[model samples]
Each structure stands twice: as structure tokens, then as C-alpha cells.
Target chain A: MKMHNFNSGPSILPQEVLNQAAEAVLNFNNIGLSLLEIGHRTSWFQDVLDESRSLIKELMQLGEEHEALYLHGGATTQFMQVPMNLLDDGETAAYCDNGIWGSKAIKEAKLFGNVNVVASSKDKNHTYINKGFEIPATSKYLHYTTNNTVEGTQWHALPETNVPLVADMSSDIFSRNMPFAKHSLIYAGAQKNMGAAGVTLVVVKKDVLGKIKRAIPPIMDYRIHIENGSLLNTPPVFAVYVSLLTLRWIKKEGGLAEMEKRAKERAEYLYNALDSLPLFVPTVNKEDRSFMNAVFVMQRPELEQPFLDECKKNGMVGVKGHRSVGGLRVSMYNAMPMDSVKAFVELMTEFNNKNL
Target chain B: MKMHNFNSGPSILPQEVLNQAAEAVLNFNNIGLSLLEIGHRTSWFQDVLDESRSLIKELMQLGEEHEALYLHGGATTQFMQVPMNLLDDGETAAYCDNGIWGSKAIKEAKLFGNVNVVASSKDKNHTYINKGFEIPATSKYLHYTTNNTVEGTQWHALPETNVPLVADMSSDIFSRNMPFAKHSLIYAGAQKNMGAAGVTLVVVKKDVLGKIKRAIPPIMDYRIHIENGSLLNTPPVFAVYVSLLTLRWIKKEGGLAEMEKRAKERAEYLYNALDSLPLFVPTVNKEDRSFMNAVFVMQRPELEQPFLDECKKNGMVGVKGHRSVGGLRVSMYNAMPMDSVKAFVELMTEFNNKNL
Candidate 1:
């Protein structure tokens, strides 16, 4: 069966990326050693690390002022480490409570210092990104999630903030055009559009560290990693290698500019079909709906399983919504082909005609 | 040219394991979706997670008291987190300073509480594990490194301590018989015998958590991971899958006993060659030499480059020692064949004769 992957994360990778990664697994760059077997310090593997860092900077148009680091301990770990490194004991960090990931970040930041939630969407079920939040003068940074993976909401524009902006772009990183230099730091877990699930990509301005009073744990501190070129200790070699390959694919496909164009096209196509189908209702607030993830619900609650089964019969995977919000979610990340989204829309339409 | 891999970590993988992982990268278990494309929550990937956790327990002969966790953030992260959960404010932790890794752990543990250096080998250049030091009665846990990659040292026996024994078994895990239940916790970075680099395997007793007065960051807290079955957040799917394959390979090759036998044979063959060679001098103390990593120096410093260049021409890789320790170190993990060791031994002999 030709299964069309709609998985949220650990999600779809391009066929060419898969082919290249598979080849590397057998024997990376014909070095007579599997990528799985090479040490991170080896010259060939160091080339991988170098290329990955270079590509991220090049794609984002980041200048020398910005330093990018590939690290272990996924984005969740970043939630605390970001605060642990940036926010001093007495200082506060402002945050926006938009969805699950943002809330988790807020929880972790509280452990380090005071967290001021300037805006929140939790009351009305997180259908929109809260806007026009005030950043406190005493705050060291303002943090937010660029896209809510579970709630299907994305910040289409960067929120204006004075104190250095930190965004968790885990699901939406490199998918669309990003105002790279505007933010102080961006951290993303590379499972969605990036690559496999082991590493996180962090881009930071080098000068921002060392201002804090408390001592940062060496492993968790951003200064040590940046100074050592992200090889302060052993990193996730295979994950980062796969991510580098994905970055190459992105560049070959015309970088994030083209990615944004294709993403917008996919979203419009599915959302139009959803708007026309009376049996299905898109769950997210349309204006704030995520281009990366399109969450929708059946008109009749009893028909959710049948619709899922019908889609399953046609080789659709991961159309099921998050358990917190019942329905279907089509995650159209950067690597997802237009044909897959077209097929999913057709499935939604055809299933509604038969069962509605 | 076919290279003989001897890198310390992210080192050699079993050929079958490589093939299996490569095939899955393209199409996992004939699921049509690439392993790189599948969601971690999917049944097949879930099966990979379950089997990996089970095998670690089954191999270690751990029963109801032991709970194995496959987590992100390598052993370095665990260096702080282990103490974060176990040690409290005003409490002290006893540490044995064997080598670089242990000292790194000591540095991280100090952030949490007072650390009493129970023993240290720094006086003798970390060539052997010091003994007969008293572990403090007020210490929360006694921490040590089971294998020192840089120093080429191993603790042949677990030290006698009244409190729980915590070990960083990053290099020598599953290669020899372990005192599984004797320790309260054991952690190893997966770049070694376990699999490729990404996840860290943590085996903890379920009831030992919540002993600390200071609050732990939820992501760093082992109790939450245990409660959620190690999937509190998205894990390193591909890394864990490869690790499961390695675990299966270990079982297919007759479990830990056979691993111990092969490890011993390889160590004896290399150590014997090192002892007999007049041109080479073993760097580690005879009583506590590592079976996994063999470190030795050329009898004359002037001949180091000539020997290294000669070995490079003859398909030897990673023969250079860590920069801090000036010599050659050959790391032969579980999947390293006795044949490769024999080939390297021959190379050492030929180089010695040619130069002399």
C-alpha cells in the first residue's frame, strides 16, 4: 500500500533526502564507513557539522552576528536552558501562552525566574495567537511559539517586542519565510520539516550570553556550545547528518521562499475544499490557522471514526486529530508533496458525499 | 578503500544492523512510508520503543524494581539531572574522580549540592581507579564512571558503598556482566555499544525519586519520564529504533555472556600485543586497563607521526588518542570483530619492525 504520511512530526522527509540518508547509512560519502559508525570528530563528520551550520545561516540570511548551534536534548530541554542561560535570578522573561508548547515553555521558565504571560489564548481553546502583548522593562526576553502544532495556529507575523525575541519554531522552522535577524534566538526540534527526531537547531546572537549572574551548567549553557562550535560534547551525529541532508534538499528546492509558496498553495487548496464541504468544519480560527497543520472536525461527531477508516482504506496515515481536540489534522510540512494534500482533500470530499 | 573503524564512540556498528537501519530509512518494515517519515506515535515505532526498553531490562536481568527509560539529551545531560533528582540542597554526594568523564560529572553535580571526592586518580594522571576512600554517611549517592574513554581505565569492581551507587557506563555498557541491581541508577550514551548517538538509556528504581527538596525541571525529572513511559515528549525515533536493532543483534549473538567473552578475547589479544611490543608502551595501569579502549604510546615521541601515517595508508582509522592524552588509543566496542583487532595488531608489529 502507498501510504500518504500526514504525521505531525518525525514526519515526512523528501524521497531524495531518504535516498541520500540511506546511502550514507550504508557508507557515508564512500568513505567505506557507515554514517552510523563514524565519530563526530572525524573530518568527514566535521564537514557534515560545518555544512549544516553554514546552510542554516545561509538559508535564514543570518549574518556573522548570529551563531547557529546544532544540539542534543530537543526543544523541550531548550525551554528551560534558554531561561537558565538568559534570565538572571531577579529578572523576568515575558511569554505568550498560545498553546501546548508555549504553556510548557512558560512552566519551565517559571522554574528559573519570574514569567509574565503578556497574552494568552487558553480561554477560548487556543484557536488564535494572542497579540499586542506588552513586554516588561525589566524582562530579559520575550518568548513565544511560532506555530502551535496541536492547536493548528501559527503567528503569521512576528510580534513586536523590544527585549530580545526568542521563538520556538519547532514545527514551522524553515517551512516559510522567516525574519531571521529580528529575533535574538530561534530554537526548533528538527523532527518536522528539518529531519529526524534527536537534535534541535538553535540560532542565537553571540553577545547575549554571560550577562547573567548565576552560573549556568556547562552542558546546558549556550556560551560553551557556541564557543566550541556546538561540539562542546558529543552531539547526536546521525540526527544532525540527516538534518544537513534535509537542508541541502531545501536549498536545492529553492530554499524557504519556494517552501512558503508551496505551503500557502497547499493550505488554500485544503481550506477551500474544507469551506465547500458542509460535512466538515475546520477547527482552527481561519485567520490564524496554520499552513503547516490544518485541523478539522466532522459535522456529525459519530462519523469521526468512519471518516478515519474510509481515509485509511485509501492509504491515508495520521489524519486523526490530537486526542485533546478530536477530529482530523492534516500536517503539510515542507517535505509533503502537493499531490498528498490533494489526495487528502479528495478523501475528505469523497467521504463526506458517501457518509454525510 | 575498506577502513577498519576503531573510533571510541559513534564507532563501529554491526553490518546487519547497518543494513536493517538503512532499509528502514527507505521503507520501514514495508510500511511504504520511510522510517524517517513515520510518526513516533505510530504502532510500528511504538513497538520499537517497547522492545528496546524490554531488551535492556531482560539483558541486565533487572526485575520489577528496575525501570528502563530511553531518553534524549546524552549522558552529559544526565550528569546534572541525576543529581537534580537524587541530591538536594545542603546534602552531599560522594564522587570517585577516575577520569575526564567522572570529573565532568563532578562539575555538574556540584551545581546541585556539595560533592565529597571519595577517591581520585588525578594524582597518577587518571591511569587507575583509586580505592579505600571513605564514602560519607550523609552523601545522597556515590557516583563513578565505569569506563574512562580518555584514560583507558575501567573499574573492575563496583565500590562498596552504603548509599545508592550511580554510574556513568557510557563506554562499557553491556560489554561485560554488570551488577544490575547493585546500583540505584545506570546511564550510558547510545553512541557506544547501544547504537548511534542520540538517546541515553536510563535505568532507575521507581521509588527513589522525590527525595530532593529542590524542584527539578520537569524535562530533567526522571520521575515524570518513568510515569509517562519515557514518551513525555517526542523521543529520538530513528536512534531508538537503531538501538533496538543493536539490542536484537546482541541477543542474536548470544546475549551479554557472549559479549563478555568476545570483549575479553579482543582485549587480551590487543593487550598482549601491547605488552610484548618493544616499540610501544601501554599508557594505562596494568591493574585497571579498559577492555573497550586500548591506549598506548610509541616508545619514542619522534616516531608517532610515521607510525600514524603508516597506519593510515594501511586502512586504520581513529588510531590517534584524545588531544589531552598524547598517544594512540584503539577503541573496540562490542560490535568490533576480533579479526579487526588481529589486523591492527599485525599493523602495530609491522610498523615497529619497519621503524626499528
Candidate 2:
């Protein structure tokens, strides 16, 4: 079966990236060495680290005002590290709790200092992002999750804040074009739209670091990796290599503007299909639907299994929703082809006509 | 040209494992989906996680007395986490400063509590492991790095401490059959003897957890990972899979007993050859020479580059000494075939004859 992968992270990557990564693992750059065996300090792997960082800067249009770093640990680790570096003891940081990721960031920040939840969508079960929410001028920084993968909501606009802005763009980074200048720090786990799961991409305005009162471990310190060129320790070489390849793919496909256009189109196609169908209900507030992940529920609960079964039989994988909110979630990341979306819509239409 | 990888870490992995990993990245398990794109929450990946964790336990001979955790971050993170979870706010922990890793561990530990250096090889420039060292009886735990990758020294025996023993066995793990039960906590970064960088293997005694005064982050708490079965967050799935394959490879090739026997033979073969050669001088105390990484300097300083050139032309990689100590280091890890050692010895002999 020619399967269409819609799994939310560790999700679909460019086929070209996969091919290149496979070739490298077998014999990297005709060196007759497996990528797994290459020394991290060697020039070949160093090129990978350099180019990956460079590409991120280019793709995001980050200027001299920002510096990029590749660090181990994932987005979850960043939840604490962000505060540990940026906020001081007893200082306050503002967070907008729109979903699970936002709440997690808020929780971790509280461990370092006081956190004021500037706004929350918890009252509405996170079905809608509460825009026009206020950010306190007293806070050291304002934090938010740009996209909620689990809850299927994404911020359509940047929150206005006088304080330094920090965003965890883990699930939707590079899928759209956003104003990069508004944020002091932007971090994303590479597993979703980037490449693999081992490395996290952190872009910070260099001047924003070194203010915290706590002794941050070297691995946790963004400044250490930035100064050492992300080679302070043995990095996850293969993951960064694949990420570079994916970044190259994104560049070749006309950068983030094209990616955003394609993503919006795909999501619109799926949403249109969902609205036309009687059997399914798109779950999130329509205005806040995520272009990255589209969540829906079956109107007739008993029909859910058969619909999933038919989709699987027709070569769909990872469409099942997260356990916390179950139904269906088609994660249309950047690499998910338009044809795959069309096929999914076709399946939905056929199922609706036959069973409605 | 055929390259022989001997880069202490991110080092040699089995060709078969590499092939399998490469294939899965393209299309996993004939599922017509790339492993890079699959949902970690799915049954497919969960199976990999389960078997990998199980294999580590089986290989380490760890039963219910200890639980193995596939942790994020690296061994460096554990340097703080071990004390944070194990020691109270004011309690002191004993540490042996064998080399760089030991020093780093002690530095991170100090962030959480007091650290008492029971013994140190620093007085001798870290070229020898201090024997007959005593652990502080009043300390909460005793910590040591079993093998110094940089200085090329290994502990022949662990300290007899009544307190819980914590070993950073990052470099020498799986190279020998050590007393696994002697330590309550053993943490290793996977890049050295295991497979790749990114994932860390932590074996913690179940009873020793839940005693710290500080509030550890969810990712920092070993107990949370243990309870969640190491799936508290999306792990470095590919790295863990590679480590699992390496563990299986070790088991199939006659387990740790056979591995130890081969490691000893390879180390002895190289050391004996170095002893007979007049051009090179071994650095560490002969009694404390590491079986994993063998460090040596040129008898005449000018001959260093020539010797390195000769080795490189003969297909040796990663023989360059660490910058802290300028000399050659031949890391004879578990996966290094005996023929490679034989080849290295031959090169040494030829170079010695030319220099003399």
C-alpha cells in the first residue's frame, strides 16, 4: 500500500530528505563510512551542524539580532530552560494557556519564578484561542505555544506584548510565515515539520541570555551551545543532518511563504470536506483551526471504527486522534502532499454518501 | 577508501543496524511509511520502546531491584538530576575526580547540594586513577566516572561505599563485566559504547527515589519516567532503537563476558605493541590503563603529525588526541573488531621502525 502518513510528529518529512539521509547512513558522501560512525568533530559532520543553523536563519529571515542553536533534550526540556535562563528568582513571566503545551511551559516557568497566566482558553476546553488577551508589562517575558498539536488550535496573529516574547513553535514552525522580530526566543522540536526528534532548534536574541539567578547546567544553557557552535558536546549528528536536508528541501520548494500557502490550501480543502459531510464534525473553533493538525469527531460514534478501517484500508495511517481527545486528527504538516489531502477528502466524501 | 572508525563516541555501530535503520527511515517495517514519520504513540513505536528497555535490563542483569530509564538530555543532565533526586538540600555527596567527566559531574552536583571530593587524580594532571580512595561515610551517595574517555583511565574496581554508589560509565560500559549491583544508580551517554548521541541509559534502584527536598521537573525526575515507562515525552526514538540493536548485537555475539574477553585482548595487544615501540610513550599509570581508550604521546614531539599521517593513510580515524592532552588515543571500544587492532599495531610497528 502507498500509505499517507498523518501522524503528529515524528511526522512526515520530505521524501528527498529521507532518501538523502538513507544514503548517508549507508555511506556518507562516498566516504565509505556510515553516518552513525562519523566523528562529530570531523569536518563533514561540522558542515551539517553549520548548514542546519544557517538554513534556519535564512528560512526564518533571522538577522544579526538573533542567534540559532541546536541542543539535545526536546521541547519539554526547553519548558524549564527558557525560564532558567531568561527569568530571575521571584521575577514574573506571563504565559497564555491555550492548550497542553502552553500549560506545560507555564508549569515549568513557575518552578523557576512566578508565572501570571495572562490568558487561558481552559474555560472553553481549549477549543478556541483567546486572542486580544493582555500581557502584563511587569513580566520578564510573555510565553505562548504558537500551535497546539493535541488540541488543534493555532495562533493566527502574534500577541501584543511590551515584554520580551517567547514562543514554543514546536508543532507548526516553518509551516507559515510569522514576524520573527517580535519574539526574543523561538524554539521548536524538529520532529514535527523539521526532521527528527533528537534535536531542538532554539533561536534567541543573544543579548537576552545570562540574566537568570540560577546556575544553569552547560547543556541547559543556551549561551554555552551558542558560544561553542552547538558542539560543546557530541550532538545528535544524524538528526541534525536530516534536519539540514529537510531545510534544504524547504528552501528548494520556495521557502516558508510557499509552505504556508500550501498548508492553508490543504487545511481548507479538508475543512471544506468536513463541513460538507454529515458524518463528521470539525472540533475546534473554526477561526482557530490549526493548519498543521485538523481534528474532527464522528457524529455517529459507532461509525468511527468503520471509517478509520476504511481509511486504513485505503492507505491512511496516524489519523486517529490523541487519547485525551479521541476521534480523528489528520496532521497536514508541510511535507504532506496535496494529493494525499485530496485522497483523504475523497475517502470522507465516499464514506459520507454511503452511510449518511 | 575503506575507513576504520575509532572515534571514541558517535563511533562504530554494526553495519546491519545501520542498514535496518536506514531502511526504516525510508519505509518502516513494510508499512509503506517512513519511521521518521510514524507516531511515537502508535503500537509500532511502542513495541520498539518496550523491547529496547527490556534488552537493556536483560543485558545489565538488572532485575526488579533496578529500573532502566531511556532519558532525554545526555549524561551531563544526569549530573544535576542524580543529586537533585537523591540528595537533600543540605546533604553532602562524595565524588571521585578521576578526569573530565568526574569533574563535570561534581560541578553539576554542587548546584543542588554540597560535594565532598574524597579523592582526586588532578594533582597528577589526571594521568592516574588514585587507588585506595575512601568514600565519606557521612555523605548521601558516592559518585565516580568509571572510565575517563579523555585521559584514558579506567577503574579496575569500584569503591566499597555503604552509601549508594553512582557511576558515570559513559565510556567503558558494556566493555567489561563490572559488578552492576555495586551501584544504586548508573548513567551512561549512549554515544560511546552504545550506539549514538541523544539518548541516555539510566539504571536506578527503585527504592532510592522520592527522597529529595527540591521539586524536580517532570523530565528531570527519574521516578516519573519510571512510572510512565520512559514515555513521559517523545523520546529520541531513533537513538534508542540503535542502542537496542547494539545491545542485541552484543548479546548475540556471546554477551558481556565475551565482550570483556575481546576488549581485554585488544587493549593488551595494542599496549604490548606500544611497549615494544620506541617512538610512542603511553601516558596513564600502567596499572590504570584504560581497556577502552588507550592514550599515548610521541616520544619525540616532532614525530606526532608524521605518526598521525601514517595512521590516517593506513585507514585509521579518530586517532587524534583530545586538545586538552596532545597525543594519540586509540579508543578500543566493544564494537572494534580484533583485526582493526591488529592493523593498528602493524601501523605502529612500521612507524616506529621508520622513526628509529
Candidate 3:
């Protein structure tokens, strides 16, 4: 049975990437040594680290001013590190709480400094993207989760901010064309669209660092990591290499433009099916719906389990929504084929006919 | 040509573990999805995480009072996290400076609280472990590196301390039987003897946490991670899985008792050969010489490159020493085979005969 993996994170990667990674594990580049055994400082693995960073810059179309780093501890670690490095004890940072991830990010930032939640859609159950948030001129930075993975909202437009922009683009990064240059710091966990689960991709402009007064630990400091070329300590070697393979695939398959086209195509197909079916209810404001993850529920909530069971019988994985949101979530990341989305919609159509 | 890998950390893993890891990457346990694609929250991965943690506790002979965690950011991250979670502001903690890793750990600990350098081998170029250093009763913990990777030193016996013992056992954990219950906390990066690079293994006594007065970030908080079962966020899924497989192998091969026997046999075989050869001189105090990494230098430094080149030509990898200490280093971790060490010693004997 061909399993359609909609896992959301540690999610579906390109088939070729999986094959290459597996081959490398056994014998890396015909070096007679497994990739698992290779030293990170050696040229064999250095090439991997170097190419991964370079590819991120190339894919984002960013310039030399922005540096890319592959760090461990994921985006969750970044929640505290971002504030620890950027926000001082007395200084304030603007934050937008649109969903679970956004709220969590805001909560972490508050520990290091004053966090001004300029916008929040929590009152409405985070179904929409809040706009026209006022950013204080004295704000150190405007922090936002560009794409809400749980609530399924994505910021299509760059926020108007004079201060440095720190965006957690964990879910929607590289899935679409964006004004990436406008942001001072852009971070994404690799599990979704990028690669695997162990590494986080951080793109930071050099000038934004060294502004804080508090002593930030070297491991948590962005300047130290960038200065060391993300080799301050032993990094997640295999994860970064898999990410490199993923980035290479992204480039070979026509870059973000093609990715964006495919993302829109898949999301539109699934969303159209969801909207057309009376048995399924697509949540979240339509305008702010995520291109990566589509959240929907059945008209009869009891039918949700039956539909998910139907999905499981037909080899659909991770169709069940996150625990916080008890509905179905069909994640259409960059690697998700349009054919898979079509099959899922067809399943939905059949389920809807029987339930209705 | 079969290359003998001896890179210090990110060293060799059991061949069967590598094969299994590669297989899992393609299709995990005959599931329709790649191991890389499976969600961590799913039962498929929960078993991996649970078994890995349980195996660590069982191997360490730890009871229910202790908890095992698989975290990201490597052992380097633990350098800061240990103090952040255990040492409070204005308090003091004891640290032993054995070598590079120990020095780094001391440096990070200072940021959190006053560090009392109970002992240091820096005066002697970190060639031997320091002894008889008084640890303060007021100290939060007595931190030391159980086995120094660089400069080739290992503490054969635990230091006498009333303070809770915190150990950075990155190089030698699971390699030898120790007073496992005596230590309050132990951490090792998985790259060395465990599995791959990415996840770190941390074993902590539950009672030691919540003693610090400082506001620890939730991400850096051990209690939070323990409470969440190391699933506070997305862990390095594949890395943890590999570690699990490696742990399973360790148990199947008679656990730490068998590992220690193999380690001693390989080390003694190589050390005996080095002693017999007049051309190559082993450094470090004989009493404190590490079983994991054997550091040596050529009698004539000029012949070092030629010897290295010769070894390279004959399929030897990572024979060059760390750049900080300019000499040759042969690492024999838990997974290192006696046959490979014997081959290396034979090569050394041949080189000595040709030169001297």
C-alpha cells in the first residue's frame, strides 16, 4: 500500500532525498565510511554544511548581509534564544499572537524582556490573521509566526515595521515567494518543508546582533554561531545533510517559484473540495488560510472519526488534526504531490457522499 | 577499500546499527512511510523515544528516581543548560578543568553563577587529571568530564565530593561500568558511542531539579523536559531512533560489561604496541591514559606528515590529532572493533621498521 504521509512535521520529504540519505548512511559518497562516522570538520562534511547554507541564501534570493545557520534544538529553542539575544531587560519587542505557536513564542519572549502583544486573534480562536498592529517606535523588533502550523493561518504580506523583523517562518518557508529581504531574522524548523526534524534553519542579518546589554550564553548567541559558521559545537550532521539534499532538490525542481505554484495548486485543490463538500467544514478565515496545512472539520463532528478511519483504510497518514484542534488537517508541504492532494480530495468526496 | 574510521566524536557506530538505520530511513519497520516522515507524536515514534530512554536508564542501572532525556543542541548546549537549571545566581558550583571540553563547560557555568575551580590540569598542559581538590559544601554541584577526548585523559575513579556529581561523559559513557548511582547527572552526545550526531543523552536525578532560584527558560529547564517526557517540542526523530537501535545493540551484546571488556582489550593491545615501538611515543600520564583516545607523537615530528600520508594511502581516516594539540590521536570508542585496532598497530609497526 502506498502511504500518503501528511505528517505535518518530520513530515514527507522528497523520495529522492530519502533514497540518497539512506545510501549515504551506508557509504557516504563512496568514501568507504558511513556518513554517520564522518567528522564534521572534515571537508567531506564541511562541503555539506557550506552548500546547505549557500543554498538557503540562494533559494531566498537574499544577499551576503544575511547569514544562514543550521542549528540544533529546533524552533522551540529559538523561542527563548531570539529574546535572549535581541531583547534587553528594559527594552520591548512587538509580537503578534495569532495561534498556538505565536502565543508560545510570545510567552517565551516575555521571560527575557517586555513583550508588547501588538496584535492577537485569540479572541476569535485564531481563525484569522490580525492586521494593522501598532508597533512601538522604541520596539527592539517585531516578532511574528509567519505561518501558524496549528491554526492554519499564514501572513501573505510582510508586516509594516521600522524595527527589525524577526519572523518564525517554520511552516510556510520556501513554500511560496515572499519578500524575505524585508526581515532581519527568518527562522524555520527543517521538519516541514525543508528536510528533517533535528535542525533549524536561521537566516539573520549581521548588524542586528550585539545590541543587547545582558550576557547571552555563547550557545544561544546568534553572533557566536554565525561567526563560527554554525560549527561552534558539533551540529546535527545527518539532519543538516538531509536538509542539504532537500535544498538541492528544491533548487533542481525549479526553486521557490515552482514550489509556490505547486503549493497553491495543492492547497486550492484540497480547499475547493473541502468548501464544495457539505460534509466537511473548512475552518480559519479563507483569506488567511495556510498554503501548507489545510484544517477542516466534518459538518457532523461524529463523522470526523469515520472519515479519518476511511482515510486510514485508504492509506492516508496524519489526516487526524493536532490535539489542540480536533479536526482533520491535510498538510500540503512543498514535497506533497498534486496527485496525492487529488486522491485525498477524491476520498473526501466519497466520504461526504456516504455521510451526507 | 575499507576505511577504518577513528574520528573522535561522530565516530563509528556498529555496522548492524548503520544498516538498520539506513533501512529505517527508506521504510521504517515496513510502514508505508519513511522513518524521517513519521510524526513524533505517533505510536510508531513514541516507542522509539520510550525504548531509548528506558534502555539508557536500564544500562546505567538507574532506578525510577532518575529520568533519561534525548535532547538537541548536542552536549555543548548542555554546558549552559546545566548551570542555567541547577546553579542559581550568587551561588557557587565546583568544576574540574581537564581539557578543552571541560574548559568550555567551566566557561559556560561561570555565566550562571560563581564557579569554584576545584581542580585544573592546565598547568601541566591538561595531560593528566587533577586530584585531591576540595569541593565546597555550599557548591550546587561538582562537575567534571569523565573522559577527556582531547589530550587523552580519563578519571579512573570518581572524585570524592558531597556535592551532587554532574558529569560530562560525552566521550566514555556506556564504555565502562562505573558508580552510576553516585552521579546526580550524566550527559553524553549521541555522536560518539551511541549512534549519530544531533541528539544528546542526558540522565538526571529527578530530585536535583527545582533547586535553582533563577528564572530558567522553559526550553532550558530540565524539569519541564522531564515533565513533558523529552517531547516538550519536536526532537531529532531519526537521531533518537538510531540511538534506540544502538542501545538495543548494546544490550544484546551483554550491555556495559561487554563494552568495557572490549574497550580495555583494544586499548591495551594498541598501547602495548605503542610501548614496544621506539619511533612512536605515547603522551599523557600512564596512570590517567584514556582507553577511548590514545594520544601519541612521532619521535621525529617531521615524519608525522609522511606517517599520516602513508596511513591515508592505506585506508586510515581521522588519524591526525586535534589541531589544539598537534600529534596523532587514535580513538577507540565502544563500537570500535579490536580487529581494526590490531590492523592499525600492525601498520604502525611496519612504519616504525621502515623508518627506524
Candidate 2 lDDT over A194-217, as tens digits, reads 898898889999888887778887
**Order of candidates by DockQ, top first?**
3, 1, 2
**Between which residue pairs do clashes occur in model 1?**
none
lDDT of each residue in B192-260, candidate 2, tens digit only? 778878889999998888877788988788888898998888888888878887888889999899999
Clashes of 2: 0
DockQ of every candidate: 0.82, 0.78, 0.91
CA RMSD of each candidate after superposition:
1.2, 1.1, 0.8
For residues B27-139, what per-residue lDDT tens digits would candidate 3 score against the true structure? 99999789999889999999888888999988989998898999888899999999988888899999999999999999999998999999999999999998888888988
lDDT of 1 by residue, B189-226 (tens): 99989998999999998767888788788888998898
For candidate 1, lDDT tens digit of each residue in A1-356?
A: 77788999889999999999999999899988999888888789889999999999999999998999998878999998999989887788889999989999999999888889999998989988777767787778889999999999999988886789999999999998889889988999999999988999999997787888887888888888988898888888888998998999999999999999999999999999999999999878878999999988889989988888888899988889887786789999998889988898888888889877
**Chain B, candidate 2: TM?**
0.98
lDDT of each: 0.90, 0.88, 0.91
Clashing residue pairs in candidate 2 (N, C-alpha, C atoms within 3 angstroms): none
Preferred candidate (lDDT higher): 2 or 3: 3
Candidate 2 chain B, which ten residues in sequence have the lowest lDDT sum? B1-10
Global lDDT for candidate 1? 0.90
Give the 10-residue window scoring lowest on summed lDDT in candidate 3 chain A: A1-10
- Where in model 2 is the C-alpha error above 4 Å? none
